[model samples]
Target: MTSTTASRPVGAKPAQGSNLSLGSLLRRPEAGAFLGLLAVLIFFAAFGGLTFLKPAGMSSWLNVAANLGIIAIPVGLLMIAGELDISVGAMVPFGAMTVAVISGHYGMSIWLGIAVTMAFGVTVGLINGYMVIRTAVPSLIVTLGSLFAVQGIVLGLTVLITKSTSVALTVDGPAKVIFGDFLFGGQLQVMVIWWLVLTAAYVFFIHFSPKGNWIFAMGGDKVSARNAGIPTDRMTIVLFVLSSTSAAFVGMCQAILYNSAQVAGGQSFIFNSIISVVVGGVLLTGGFGSVVGIFFGTITFAIVNQGIYYTDFDRNWSALIIGVLLLLAVLMNNTFRKMALSATTKKKGA
Candidate 1:
């Protein structure tokens, strides 16, 4: 029997009936992204050598992946919900500076600094959500405006209060041990554990709860979702807050881990997070994605970004290779996406 579907992208909702088969699995939204991730892994392993798979090498990319994934997952959730938050780039440094200036520079309690840092994330998230909801503008435009504005605010306030663009932080006791510390023989970061824990929480929320269904509905059609009592505005606002707060948390952790904060280093995150999300199989149009897909995509991107270090390719040509490989991965993902659509059409026609 033909399964009734909505205008929603494939995978926006759960599959209609229980019919387990290879075709069914392949048609799942995240399948294409997962295959692409596997392809990238094999390619890097072949040329990048076994050293790339070593503990140290694995840690390098895993660490980077965790950091990027933490922010990217929330960013992915926002996209799935039909919103964006570019201001996270700025929030990272802002959060770090908030903690550093408060606790480190002024010698206040580290716990207080951390609390304020997260609070700042929530406040910015609220502003972003409010502007988008109240003004009826595209989330991209709203967040873009926030991007520069927050960056400037952070820079201005940081320089004004500390008289410097960079700040130092010193932490000890439980705060140091928990938020940021070298673990697993200093090759791994505490953030990795945080990332895993957060990922689990997100997985539960996105896949195992009624809330996940609401999120998918929002992505499928916000207006319809709202009419169905999904509370689109509230969800959007909450998503924005989560994104900003997550970014801030990363920044705060980095500061505590490294004992320093720089106002200029977090801008790369804006693009990197989006790229990871897209690569992970989230549709730019929203309404179709999986957190597991995002996790794999983040790993694929990190491998591409860091796997080059282990290869014999000339250092000067690294960027070109990374770009080419990433494009190839995207192309592969598209092929599977097309296959999924084709399967859907066949099933409907049959």
Candidate 2:
């Protein structure tokens, strides 16, 4: 028995590498984004003068983050789960318009309008997910189609119902209290608090939960995950639905805050949110990212994208800075991807 045990096959010992705590973050995709954010802050503080660090500047940038972070969070999750939802731009308007039409034009209760808006968002999400999973179509294509289709539907229906593209909302009482209330300074938005809280909760969930593990696994390798008993299809669908639902909620919140909804309100978010997610360290190809990274990324993008205007630099330079940032993000993503793949090879060799 001892001789047989000696001859039995056993796995090789793990390789000894660098004792770098938490691994080489430089080898991590998010490292570049982290560095980039610090660099931006330093540059702005040095050149943007004292105002860049002031409460007014803080409010300006944080407000932008709050608005953009909502979509960025969901979009980041979808990317991590190995999918996309370009339709969120339209979904935002869809939810807002649904509420506007129901509450403003149809004389329905605010709660009913809110319910209808959420339900419509859910239905759209389900349809998008079902089609993607059942047909095995690329999420990019499916959501792109959904984006256009929803845009058309929202435009046509809004025109048909209200004979106008914009709807005025008269929100008061609790709605105003929830959306318009300020927590810190007259500049601080309630949405800013909401964004931070949601980011922390999502980070906790993604890092600690079994479901979050499944999400990452499915994104990393769907076939391997399914073989290992993960419900890849269901997870994919649920992710898409979650993305849509979040966008809808943001839209509803905007509607309440602004007390108006326009058919064209969310169009800019399609590109902006994607850019923010990419800048944060989430790979477009899927898997290997963090909600904290995205949170930081959104803040970075918001500051850089909006802060440029306050600088002596021409506003056109804003576009240039964003482009440069995006190029850098792409380069960092490739570098980290190569490292991750190499890690896999090293594991196998060991």
Best by lDDT: 1
Candidate 1 regions with alpha-carbon error over 4 angstroms? 1-20, 316-318, 341-350
lDDT digits (tens) for residues 99-217 of candidate 1: 99999889999999999999999999999999989997898999899889988988998899889999999999999989988785567888999999998999899988889878888
RMSD per model, one decimal:
4.7, 6.0
lDDT (C-alpha) at residue 27 in model 2: 64
What is the number of backbone collisions in each predicted candidate, taken in the order shown? Answer: 0, 0
Lowest lDDT 10-mer window, candidate 1?
Answer: 1-10
The CA lDDT at 20 in model 1 is 54
Model 2 segments beyond 4 Å from truth?
A: 1-23, 337-350
- The estimated TM-scores of all candidates read 0.91, 0.89
